[model samples]
Structures are given as structure tokens and as C-alpha cells.
Target: MKNILKYMSLAFVGGIIFASCEKSRPVVYTGENFVAFEDTLLSIPESSAKEDANGETQAIPSIATIRINRGSGDISKDLVVSYSVKAKYVTTDTLGNEVILGDVPEGNFYLSSPGAVTIKAGEGFAFITVTVVDNDQTDGNKKLTFTIESTSDASFTIGYPGPDKKAKSMVLYIEDDDCPLDINDFVGTLKVEDVAIVSTPLEHSYLVTSTQVSPNSISILGLFDPVTRYPSPTPCPAPVVLVFNTATKDVIFSPTTQTAYYRSGGCPATTNPRVVYPDPAVPNKFNTCQKLFTLNYYVRNPSASGPFDFVYSTVSKP
Candidate 1:
């Protein structure tokens, strides 16, 4: 009986030994103990294109940019995006010409803080866009809607036709009197620079110079009035878009805004198209509808190239 018990004990020991001798598998740190990769994107800033009442048409100008990125834990990883434009006031046209959202990385990339764009005078109208180049297209609103209203007097303004294809610009505000609100309050005679006729190009252009008012501010410029239709019905059911008026050389905001319309193509030729108040003390940021110093340009129609200054700027008063 003793021998039999000893053999049983040996067998148990051998079994335990065999189990311990087997190869150890690798250990995995996971779940609550696991390290996590970064998630994509933080928040985007207030990118709404707000316009002050200046320039050809009210346009928001911006040169600054915001850097979108992942959290610190995921900063080392690569990121890509898909883009779309979300305009609260109106719908955006499908012109791929609005592509700065796509080509941003190519320009320059140093991690800058929240970027901003300032529309001095001739500078307004950027591709107010958002994109998720690396992610799915359904991430957010991809299309932007510009505010559009149907008025008899809708239009855009073009700058002086120049020697080079490049030209500075501003959008002309078409008066919209039919708009229910008081469009005339902002339509007082504007203070502008002196002018003479320059017909070397034979177009009988005006040689206009400029002036400016700092801290210029603007209130909403148009509203619709339909007092007669019915008390039950609302006025201006939708947004409106601007149109070009070659006949008047001015963009008429609406048919009712006939008298308040400004003439087109008559800004004084200034050596510095961007400077508004010709003050050496203020150095930069001249606030004028017409360019006070210098103006910048981007070619809209590459195929339709010529010695034409497509867009220009000049002084304007509210």
C-alpha cells in the first residue's frame, strides 16, 4: 500500500512538471490597459462669411486659415479629409472653381492657431468651404447655399479692364427696395475721390482717386415689403442672388431700388489701389470701397484670357 501511494504522488508531480514545461505564449496588453490611437479633428471656428457694406458687392475677405487636427495622443498619425460647404443663408452653386478647400495642404503647413480672413475693401469672397478629404463624404454638409432672392434689379460689378489679366475687385451692392426693409437709409450720396476722363484705352474711363472711413460698419442692407398681397401671407419667402447689369453699369439689388443704384466703372486711378485714406501713419488696412492702395486678383476664366483687368476697387461711402 505504501509503494502504491508513492507511485501516485510521483505521477501527480510529473503531470504538474509537464504542464509547466510547455512553451509560454506572448502576453497582450488590451482593453482598460491598452494604449489608444488618436481620433480625427477638433472643432472648426466661426467660418461664416460676413460682409460689411463696402466694395462692388458686399463680400467677406479672408487670407487666414485654421489648422484642423487630431488630439495630442493621435498627433503623430496621418490624417486626410472630405470637404463640403455649409452656408446657412443660401445654396451654393456646383462650381468646382471653389477649390481652395481642396488645395490647402499644397500652399504651406506650419501648425498655426485658428486662422482668420479679413476683407479689407477689394478683398472679399473666398470659397467658404469645409472638407473631409480622408473620411467619408457623409461627415457633414458638403454644399453651400448663397443667399438668393429674386428681384428685378440683381447684378454684380466688374473692375476696370486692365493691361494684364489680373485685376483687383469688389462686388457692387444692388439696391433692393422691393425688399420689405428700408434699403434707402444706407443710400445717401457716398463721399468719393476726384475724377477726370482717361480714354487712352478709348473706353472713356474715369480717372478716379480715393478716401476712406475707418471702423466702417454695416447693418443688414435689404428686406422685402408686400403690404398689399394679404395680411396672412409673409414677405420674402426666400434668399436672393445678385446679377450683373451691363445696361446700367450697376448691379440693381431689386426693381424697387432703381434710384439708389450706383454707376459702374468710374474709380480714380490710384498708384496704390488698396490704400483708402492716403495716410503714411496708418501704413496699412485702408478702409475704402474703392482701393486706396493696391489691389490683388485671381483669374476666373483662364480660357478667356486677354489684356483685361477683370476686377478693380474704389472708395465708397455709406
Candidate 2:
């Protein structure tokens, strides 16, 4: 009986092994061949201005490359893909409401050969190029949409899974590069409004004169003197300068270690306050179009103990 039991266990183990070794049917790709856009949304940066050899500043046009991809198909034969462009595209917002984004004007962009790209033999991808025209006028950012209309080879589908998929269309955002930094705009008289105060309260509204110190920097001559509780001299003994970032529109105090006086409780007499962004969530930036400065910073006396004061200020051009 013991020998019969041992043989039965061995037979069961062999049966399990045989079942595991048996191969299942292979997964066959029954879907048809298709072509689709590599990306649904794309951005083209604003054209930049460069000095030519003749000493003339010229605008360099921005180019955008749109890619088409082929899936599950023999790429040995050349395939011609045709696309259509529209001024606007219809999309849904977060609330599921339909939104139309067709802001691009007719003269803002030039498409090469009316949206046709050829996937060469033995290649699975092709590209179409669009040249963004720089009008040198600040008209805001624009958008254009392109849709895969048809193909020279009818055997391949318009989009990967189906023509109705998101890959069948692409949206191009052409950013504005027309706003060039002019240092003169930051010059003249400006008003500094203290929106939020920390430690000692400064003036509610103060007038300061700004002079262009450099191409991208300016000196504010009449900044409030924290020590004296009054406006500083015309030529400030401790110069207060603000530097502008041309690309990002960010403003920062050049000499970040400037000293100021605070007389509030738990604070020392003097403090070296550095310029910093008030909130990490929102950007500390200068609006060139509106000529506004939104800034946030802290004034802390290192010699003091406990909490320090946070200052929120806005400088605007009158």
C-alpha cells in the first residue's frame, strides 16, 4: 500500500509538470495599420531678435516640427500623409463645457506645402514643418490646430486606433516674442504701495524716483529709510537698485544684504533684509505690459529672537 501511494504522488507531480509545459495560443495583432501624430499639444517659442553682420537687428523666425508615426505596418513602401489646418479647435473645459481655441491669425504662421509629409520607404516616421512669423507687434499668444485628413495609401488608417482618437489632431501654440525690454520704461517716478507690513509699519504710499543704471537695472533714489522713518536722500548713501530679468520678467534686489531698522517687539534695532518671493505658489514678477511690480520679502533681525516680520509690497508706474 505504501508503494502504491508513493507511485500515485509521482504520477500526479508528472501530470502537473506536463500541464505547465503545454503552450498557450499566441496573441495575434488583429488591428489594422494606422498613422497618428506623436503629440496632441505642442508649443513654439517666440521668435528671437539677433544682430546681423550688417549691424541690423533682425527677427529670427521660429520653426515647429510635427511628427507622424506609423504603427503595426510594413514601412517598406512610401506613404504620403495629408493634414488639414484650422484657425480654431474645439475642446472641453474642466467643467465639461466646450471651448474653442482658434486664436491664431492668418498671417502669423506659414505651413510648408499645405500639411503633407512623406514617410519614406523603410521608415516608420515623417515630419511636417511650420514657420512661425514674427510680426514684431505684441498681440498675445495664438493657437492653431492640425488634423490628419487622409493618406496616399488607403491601407493605413488615419490615426493609431481610430480616426476619432486624440492622436489624429495636434494643437500648436505660437508664443508672442514681440515685447522687447526697454530700460526707459522702468525710469521716472514710481509709487511704492505697502500692501502688507511686518515689524515696524512703513508709509502707506511713498513716491520714489528711478534712474536707469544699466540696460537691465535701475536705481531707486528715494526709497524709505527704515532707520530714520523718512525717505532717503536723492542720491541714496546706500544705493537701492533693482535688477530685471529680460527673459523671465523677474525682479530682484542686486545687493541682497541691505540693512534696515525695525523697532517692533522681539526684534533688534537693525536687520539685513534680503529680497525674496513672498509666496512660493505665486511668481514674483514684473509685468512689462502693465508696468507693475508684485514683490514679497521678509525683514528679519538676526540678532533678535522669535518670529520676524514679512513685507508684501507692490511698485507701480503712475
Candidate 3:
């Protein structure tokens, strides 16, 4: 009888321990619903450019489609997702380098609705349409961000945590497509104002004639005479050749780095004269509408450890 009683006590204690362990187990959530952007980043051009039959380029209005996906959700019921426009700012990295991201200004784009999308019943996705306004003047690229705020159903989660442990947000970059570059327009005599930024600034104004070398390249004759302090005439020993990047509208030196001028009687050899793009905070581009070039560059001599002189030049065609 004592043996049977001891066995019963052991069985009762085993049952209590099993119950305690069952209570301590973490609850697994397998039915959680999540809604997230189909794509984290998207790009929309300001206009659609296509080559015409006449071998000329034409521009058309552009539109973008943004999609939102519903994951592990009941398809029998409609899900309403609300979004909000979030302001994006330029930030710096650990090295203190600026991460260049410019926000889109108002009136540049239009959305289908103020801030919402609805996934219809029996559907797993919804879309939002965006139309861009064409800009006649040159402006740098801009970005817009939309964040999923909430869902109509309390059981649905907005976004799932990504590998970075941050919720997914939709980021759209708007490309500026204003005033396409035409090399023919730049062929002629252009008035230039070059200023050397030194302890004592030196300024010179002259005219340089540009000739088309290729479809997107131009060679300018007679840049400037450093010794005479005047505009060099045609048949200059060293002509400045520039290549234009039609997509980004950036003007670059053809050879990337070249000798602007040869050393005179006692002057050091001019080496590594190249165009330096402006800072991210400033606009650096060839203005097609204005027919102007605003550029910054540095001239280095063989004797100089770094750049010898920093110069800002504006070449405009009237």
C-alpha cells in the first residue's frame, strides 16, 4: 500500500511540472497581418523622352504607379491603408560626408488621393498613381517619401521590420528633365567671365568661340592669356575641350585632367587643370535654357603640392 501511495505522489508532482512548463512557453503569433510597400525605392522621370521620326527628341507627360502589398491577410474583406507624406532631410554619415538627398518641393507632383489606398475585396494589392509636373528650368533631382501610417483593421500591421530593423517606407526620386542639351545651340562665340579666387581676386572677361567636335562634345578656341591678361585669339596652342553629359547636364573636361596652358619662360607647367563640381548644397549644371555655364575648377602647376588657383567661370551665349 505504501509503494502505491509513493507512486501516486510522483505522478501528481510530474503533472504540476508539466502544467508549469506549458504556461511558461512563449505564444507563437502566426496569424498577424502585414501591409508593406511593394518597392522601397522608385524613380520617376519628369517627362518621357523619345526620338521622333524626324530624328528629333520629343517630351511627353510622365506618370508613376506605386503599389502596396497585403501579406497574410483575409482576402474576403477590403483593407484600407492610410499613408502620410514624410519630410526627408539630408543627413551625414559617420565620416561626416553629406548624404545628398533633396526633398521635392510642393506643386511638383500630384497623387491620386491625398493620403490613402484601398485593397479591394479578393485582392492582395493596391496601387496609387502619381503624375509629375514638367519644369522648364533646370533643377536638381528631388525625393519624396511616403510612410504607411495605419490600417483600418486593428489586427493588421503597417510594415514588417526589414533586415536593418527599420520599417519599410516608400521613397520616390523625381528626375528633372528640363531643357535638353543641344550641342548646336552652344556653337558660336560665347562671352566668358573668369575669376581666380585667391587672396587678391583676379578677374578677366573675354570671348571664346566653340566648335562642335562630336555629337556631345565642343572645343573652345582662345580661352585666356595669363601673361598678356587678354583673350587669346584663334589657333591657340592649347584649346579647352569639354564633353557634356546630356542625362545629368554635367560638363566635364574631355580628358578629365588636362594642361590648360604650357609653361612660359620661367612659369611652371600647368598640369591637372580640371573641372570641380560644386558642393551638394549648390547647383552645378549647364543651363540649357539660359545658355550659360556656371562652373568651378582648379588649376595646378607642377611645382604646387595641390591646386594652385581656384577659379569660377561663367560662359554665356547671347
Candidate 4:
């Protein structure tokens, strides 16, 4: 009887092992493999195209990329992905806010050629060029939607449901050039934390003002004495001129401008003889909305060199 019981126990263990192996078997997709956009979303910046010497806008097209992976089988041939543009993907609510629930009417604000993209054999990626045309409309609510429908091969599927809906589909917003500039967004008091003047260290705070010099330029002013929080005694120096690239949020300091002023005083009463933007200063950071900005620079002169950091906080403008 004991021998019989042992045999039964062994049979039960073997059955359990067999069940687990069957359940854990890898799922093999016999259909054609698939491809998706490299990124879930693409944001085309405002003023994406540059103007030529004649002031005519250059033709600039936004590009979206697609990629695929080799499953158990190698891709022996090219895989072509066909896509379409539709207006039924999103809509705006009564409040003018974007609601991604329903679709809108079809339009020609965006155009794409060859509606299909091909992922070459042995290669995993391809790009689609999308051109955006200005409609001369001031409305800030323009958008374009693209969807991947089917592929040349049968085994692949379009986009996955939920979480990944953006991967197989995308919405592009066309920024309005006539939108009002948010001037107060970058005007505030910044703490000039550190000044490396040769050997003497000077720390102070100053107020900065922003003036829109052009569609893509801003003049920075109101830089005052850090200690007194007043205008620098030297009135002969000029304010720094910055070219703000709205698309990239990059502030480029014009080389022709002088950021630091020379002070005339006593021992070198020469208390603070020189203040200049260090060439090694780190790049500044700005937000997409231009509401806030961070300024970073190294201060150096014949006397000392060190980092100066400032963070722009929101303040009410008079």
C-alpha cells in the first residue's frame, strides 16, 4: 500500500509540471510583424520655417519616424506602412479647450505626399515628411491628425489600443504667428547669486526687464547693482541684447554686446572693478510657454571668475 501511495504522489507532481510548461509557452504571432512611430508625439514649434533674405518663408516640413523589430523571423523583404489623415479624432469643447473625444471636419491645413512609408528590409526605421501650410488664420486652435490604417503585409496590425493609441496615431498643432506675446512672462527679479571678480567675491540681487525687440528677439534691461539693488553707477554701459528662438527656447547673447560694466572708484576704491559674463557659463533654460526662464553665467574679470545663477519667478507687472 505504501508503494502505491508513492507512485500516485509522483504522478501528481509530473502533471503540475506539464501544466505550467503549457501555460508559459511563448505566444508566436504567425501574422506579418508590425511597425509604429518612433515617438508617441511630435510637437512642431511656432515659426518652424525660416525667412529668406527676401523675407519669404522657406518651405519647412515636419518629419515623423517609424520603426519595426524582427520577431522570431527575420524581415526578408521591405514592409510598407500606409496611413491616412482624418478629422474625426479630436474636437474642441464650448470653452475652446481641446477635447480628444470626437473628430472635426476635414481640411487642407496639412499635406503629405506618398501617404505610405516603407521600412526597408534588414533596416528597422523610416521617416515620413509632413508639410504644414499657413492658412493666414489667427485662431490658435488648428491641428492635424494622422492615422496608420493598414500595411502591405497581412501579418501586421495598425496601432495598439489605449496607452499606445498615440504611437499609431498623432496630432500636430499649428501655432499661430499672430498670437499676442506674453511680455510679463519673463520679467522678474533674479538673484545674482555669485560673482567671481578676480579674487574678491561679490554676491547681490538684481531686477531684469524684457522688451520685445522683434518677433524673435528680446532686449534684456534693468540690470542693477547687486548690493544696492539700484542702477549701476556707470551709465555708459549698454544693456545685453538677446536673440530668443521661440521654437527652441534658446537665448543667444549677441557677441557685439557687453554684458559687464567697468567701474571707476577707489584701491582699486576699485571695490568692484569689473563684471562680465563668463564665456564658460552654462546655457539658460526656458519653458515652451515662455512663462519662466533660468539664467546662468560665469562672472570673471582681471580680478576673479565664478558662476552666477538666477531663476526668474512670476511677478505682477505694473
Worst 10 residues of 1 by lDDT: 1-10
Give me the overall lDDT of model 1. 0.21
The stretch of ten residues in a row with the least summed lDDT in candidate 4 is 1-10
TM for candidate 2 is 0.42
Q: Per-residue lDDT for 102 in model 4?
A: 45
User: Candidate 3's error at 25, in angstroms?
Assistant: 32
Overall lDDT per candidate, in order of appearance: 0.21, 0.60, 0.62, 0.46
Measured against the true structure, the TM-scores of the candidates, in listed sequence, are: 0.19, 0.42, 0.43, 0.37
Give one digit per residue, the lDDT tens place, for model 2 in 193-219: 764454566546777778999998887
lDDT by residue (162-202, candidate 1, tens digit) is 34311121111111111111223223333322221122211
lDDT per residue for candidate 3 within 123-148, as digits (tens), equals: 77777666566655344555667788
Cα TM-score of candidate 4: 0.37
Residue-wise C-alpha lDDT for candidate 4, range 80-193, written one tens digit per residue: 777665533333575876565543433332223226666666554555554444332333444555667778887665654344544677765544453333544544433333
* Cα error of candidate 4 at position 239, Å: 37
**How close to the true structure is residue 2 of candidate 4, measured as C-alpha lDDT?**
8
